[model samples]
Target: MRPALYWIRRDLRLADNPALHAAARAGRPVIPVYIHAPAEAGDWAPGSASNWWLHHSLQALADALAARGLPLIVREGESLATIVELIAETGAEAVHWNRLYEPARIEHDTRVKQRLKAEGIDAHSHNAALLHEPWTIQTGTGGDYKAFTPFWRACRRQAEPAPPLSVPTDLAAPDGARDLAGAVVPPAGITAPLDALDLLPRVDWAEGLRRTWQPGEQGAQDRLGGFMETALADYREGREQPAVAGTSRLSPHLHHGEISPRQIWQAVQTQLARHGAEGDRLDSAEMFLSEIGWREFAQHVLYHHPEFPDAPLNPRFADFPWQEDPGDQLLGAWQRGETGIPLVDAGMRELYTTGWMHNRVRMVVGSFLVKNLRLPWQAGEAWFWETLVDADLASNSLGWQWVAGSGADAAPYFRVFNPIRQGERFDADGAYIAQWLPALAGLPAKHRQAPWQAPASVLGDAGVTLGVHYPHPLVDLKESRQAALAAFEQIKKGA
Candidate 1:
């Protein structure tokens, strides 16, 4: 039998990989390939931090595949053309891959599948990313759902997600397989060395990323285990506190296909079974799983509305008067974590240094950007795309739009976050603020939340000078809130 080619994309793990399992079950020699074609992603290509994760994750995947007696072929160019070339070179009769939901990827994959099938090649795609593929769940009226509550409830009413597949023990490599133990030499220019893809930054800005994350399957499992052991008991309350390691830091792992939602679901189910269903454990477990539901909801929205990344779901936002930053002065300040709002600054700085931010702080920073600064949400969305290791187009777009009050099930336009109040409520001890904004460390916890409000004597005692040691609040909170409300009113009237 001819060899089968596994086109590796986001799904990078050996376990619970449906597409890989199908290829292995064919009883044919298997070849795994990763094609680097960022341009094919359109304007939403993987950002710098994402590329950094990809570089490490791919290296990890290559090592794992080598242990299983297969070599991972790394290539660059158009995905379809490269796949066709690999098929010809390997004489592979089948190409299998996991599915991706981004607009550009959907279009690209649809064309590739149709073209390949027309030419008598077996092209199979599977759902290794989402517990349930987007189209499988729908509203009673048979229309796509715009509200998360209904959407998630519908998901829960359906069958539980299937158990994840185990790693395959039997595998065979095709003839002329590249040696995984040493330097790769491309055969007739069909493949490139992983380094040739140049996914890493040229300037070495990723030291912080390296310190903060482990990028492959083993890392994903370790993170999951830690979360279950220590954090799952208090997740409902602890997740709201940014200073605590309360939530599972498995996003980058999930985004890179290092872990599957089904795997996570099953893990949580096992925990629930150990502790019966009527206590804090059950509540916390359900809360954590609901977050996974939100991730599913984001993908569902994007799959149904392909214009989601660039356009607003609520049409009124089209005429919304977004303030001009004029050379991005406000945007730049926010991006660099100099916004003078303690919680927002802390969140932004944490994101820049760690390539991730706490969920609670993410909401505060996002609200400060679109509501207080009055800047366009897309600016914030684009910045996050470049800096976040787990930047998924669907989730990123949904988050920004939700903050800007322009997405489905969005926060009300009038509900502007007061960063001071948010900080005091969530980080009442100032630990989170002190960790990220060390300049304000000496101030009282209350004063740390708002230094400008502190007395001059307090500022002096702390060795802080507004606009010198720490920036003044970029915009007066009360004034910005009123201005944002007025702008929102204008759009409401027009709508």
Candidate 2:
């Protein structure tokens, strides 16, 4: 059998990995490799949180592959040059990898493939990132679906994916006549790169992220199992309540291909089969599934519309006047979880300490920064990029657009999320805030919901002083709401 090189990119795990399965099936010695791309390769880069997770994941993966008697080769820098060198050294005729839908990635791989084919080498790419390839789902005129509901409906109507392929334990690569070994290390003169290359939280305060999430394959599977067993029953509840473990926090896993969406989909299908797919699981499962769709949708949009990430998706919003970070104080306040807004601060602090945030406050805080503070969506997007372990380009960008009301299928410009109302409604008992911000732990749950309104006596009693123990509401809701509404009105009216 011809030798094959299995290039590991985002897909990190051994089980249910289609590209890895294919490479091993040749019964050749599968040369497994991971190419650590530069963190600063692009404008929208992997943030600090992802890098921390990535470093540890690499360590975990190397150990896992070594246990299976396979060397997990770690290469840093340009993949094409390294692959060509590896192919020549091993005398391999073919190299296989999973497909990526990002526009830049597509361009990069296409050039690499063409270059290899010109040299008489076969380059294979598999669709393992998404359930359905971008071109597979289409509209009446053979155009891509722009809106999500129709696209999802079309996807649901089509045949589901074939069963996931399993990773074979015995695959090996044949050694070539020429001795070939290129151990990879950080490239020459790369000083203090961003942290996405390894697995650690961006913000250091998260005992929750450390306790709740594991960064490797085992962690991914354990999270899936835990969600299915304890938290999944109330996913909707758990998802929105930052205080509870309600939803499947499998995004970083899915993002990294540690666990394929198909595995997650199949898991949901299996559970729904036993649990009747009707009650909370239905809502939770479907809710979680919609998140997957959103991921696909972001990729779909970026794949088709190359400029979607850099600029506004809607053309008219191009000239929309928006502020960037107001000042270090403002951005710092938001980052340190002292926004004087309880839920926003809690979520921010949660991200600061743990490198993760609940989806509910993601919108609330995203809106508050963009809509209320009148900052640019890109600003918030970048913060999430740096802070969120699950930060994804498509999801993060599209989510910011949705919150900023400048994206496709986005929330209306007028619909600014009222942080106070949102906090009171979603985090009713203030349990979520109290969990992260211990200074307010003694306050009655009601005081947490509205700390500014509590009388001085109540503040003194709880050992909480407004703007001291906790910052007072930095931006008032009613005034900020009207201001945001006015700004959005201008954005809509082309003012």
Candidate 3:
């Protein structure tokens, strides 16, 4: 049989990978390859933290494929040129890969597929990341759903997602493949060592990220197992509390395609059955699945609206008067966790330290950036694109646009979140704040969330000195909020 190249992209796992399964089942010797092509990713290429995770994830994938007796070929270049060159050298008849939804990727993949087919090589793509392709789900009028509720409802009405493909345990590789295990140029042109990707940081800034995450398929499974055992029951409320480990930290893994949503959905169902979970337990499981639905919804929006990463979906937002942060001092303070708003500061600090943050805290900080600070949502999005390990274009775009009231089903522009009240309600005990903002650790729970409001005695008792140990709020919450509202009023009138 002629050889086939299994092109690995986001789908980096052995199991539940449709492209890999198809390649193996073609009765041809399969050569697995990962092409490092960051330039193809356009403006939102993997960030520093994401690159770190990608390095580890690729290493893990390489090891797994090697153990299965298939050497994963690592190449670097324009994807089509590299793959076409590989085909010529290996005498391969086919190339297969799971699809990616980002606009640039879609354009590149389409060109490659057409070019490969013109050369009479079988070029195939499969759906592995999402439960269903974005175009497959639609409203009764054959239009994309603008709101999440109707979209998810439509998804639920469809047939359940196909069962995940089983892991390909035994596989045959092409001729001379074993000899090509570590070969940089074994008749297939140039290849780079995994280390040559420059994915790791030169300054060793990721110790906290290393301690907090394990970035591969096994790691994803391990995280899911732990979540089902301990946190799935309280996910509804526990996810809201930052101090508790009530949420599944599976986002980076999911973003990397080390694990599929199908695996997660099935795993949750099986776990529920094993424990005979009912009542609130079942509700929590459903809520967790709905979060997964939101991920699908984000992708759906991105696929239909390819301009999602930069532009507002709602046209009226085009005229919104966003504040200009001269010299970016406001943005700098927010990014560095010196905003003097305890919860927002703590959330930003947690992200800086661990490359991750709690979901509720993410919302609070997002609101503070766009609403309270009246800054451009694009600024916050860019910062997150640089810092977050799980910075998916679809989700990041949806989140920032949603927070700014410029996207589908967005929060109203006038509903600015009061960081103090948000802190009091969510981080009621202030444990989340104290953990990240250690200077406020000695303050009472009441004062920790809003030390500016605390009496001079309380501040003194906590050993805190305003503008010395901690800065005052950058903008007065009340005054800034009204200014944001006034700006919104101007845009509303223009509309």
Candidate 4:
């Protein structure tokens, strides 16, 4: 049998990887290869922060493959051209890879498969990323679902996902193959070392990211273990409070394919068994699974609506008057975390420094961007696509559209998030605000959420000057919110 090429995409890990397992089971020497083709990602290529995570994740994957006595071949160029050349050089007769749902990627992969089959080379794709492929779940009317609640309910009623596959105990390399995991010998004309890909930034802006994350398969498992041990108990409350380690923080790992959702689902089930008698634990576990379901829903929506990343799913938003702040001046301030709103700024700074944000805080800052600032939701989506390590195409589009009230089951257009109220309610003691906005750390907890509301004497005692030490609120929440409502109402009337 001819050797099989295991083309690595986002599904980076060996464990629970159906494509990798299938390639190995073909009874031929397996050639594991990863092609870095950012241009193919189109307008949503990996940004600086995500690139940093990718660099480390790839290195970790290389080490793991080496441990199993197989080499990882890394290349950078046009994916199809590079892979075809790889097939020629390696004498591989078949190629296997995990499927990606992004529109550009789907088009590219379809073309590649068609070309490979024409050339008499077998090509195959497997579902390693999502538990259920997008088309598999549908509404009672036999059409795609527009809302998450029913979509997830249908998902639950389907057969439970099978147990995750264990990593192959023995990986067979092609005869005459030498162990060369990190070594790079690309098809000559277009080959660069992983370091040469220049995924890291020149400036040292990643110290916080480094401290806050460990980006590999083992690191993902470790983070999940920590979350289960301490944070899972109060997960419902802990996830809401940004200051606490209440959430799993497994998103970047999930995005990079360092771990599979099936693995996570199975692990959560095991953890659930540990709390067999408790109702709260069961409820919290179910809630966490629903978050995963939301991710699935995002993919399903994006799969059906390929243009989701750039446009609103709801037709009414096409005519909605999106605010234009000349030069994106307001958007820039929000991105820089200098908007003078503690909770919003805190979430933005957290994302800038750590490449992750609390889900609740994400909603707060998203609402501020789309509604309070009245900026186009696309602007915020673009910024997040660049800043977030877990910047998934499906989720980013779904989340921003949800906040902007332009997607299915989105927050009602009239519902504008008042950042002050959100902060006071969620970050009641101001721990989250103080941690991210250290300039206002000395302020009493009551004043931390709204420094401008505090009395002049109180501000002086805290050693904070409204505009000097900390800037004043960018826009009055009440006034901006009304403006957003009026604008949305116009769209409604026209619709």
- How does each model score on TM-score? 0.96, 0.92, 0.96, 0.96
The global C-alpha lDDT for each of the candidates, from Candidate 1 onward, is 0.89, 0.76, 0.87, 0.87
Candidate 1 lDDT over 1-495, as tens digits, reads: 888989999998999999999888857788888888999898888999999999999888887887766778887779999889888877998999999999899998999999999999999998999987889998888889899999999999999999999987787778764432234433322322567778899999888899989999999999999998899989999999999999999999999999999999999988878867668998999999999999999999999999988998888898888898789899999999998988999999999998999988888999999999998888899999999999999999899989988897888888999999999899999999999999999998889999999999999999999999899989999999999999999988633
- Summing lDDT over every window of 10 consecutive residues in candidate 2, give the lowest-scoring window: 185-194
RMSD of each: 2.5, 4.1, 2.4, 2.8
Considering TM-score, where higher is better, how would the candidates rank from best to worst? 1, 3, 4, 2
Greater-TM-score candidate between 2 and 4? 4
For candidate 1, give the lDDT of residue 34. Answer: 88
Output the worst ten-in-a-row residue range by lDDT, candidate 4: 183-192
Better candidate by lDDT, 1 or 2 = 1
Best by lDDT: 1
lDDT per residue for candidate 4 within 167-240, as digits (tens), equals: 87757667432222334433222222468678899887999999999888999989888888887767777788
In model 3, the clashing pairs are none
Task: Estimate, for each residue in 471-495, the C-alpha lDDT of model 3 and write its tens digit.
Answer: 9989898988888888888878533
Candidate 2, residues 301-355, lDDT tens digits: the string is 7777778777888766776666555456666777777788888888898887777
lDDT of 3: 0.87
Provide the lDDT at 430 for model 3.
89
- Model 1 bad stretches (over 4 Å): 178-192
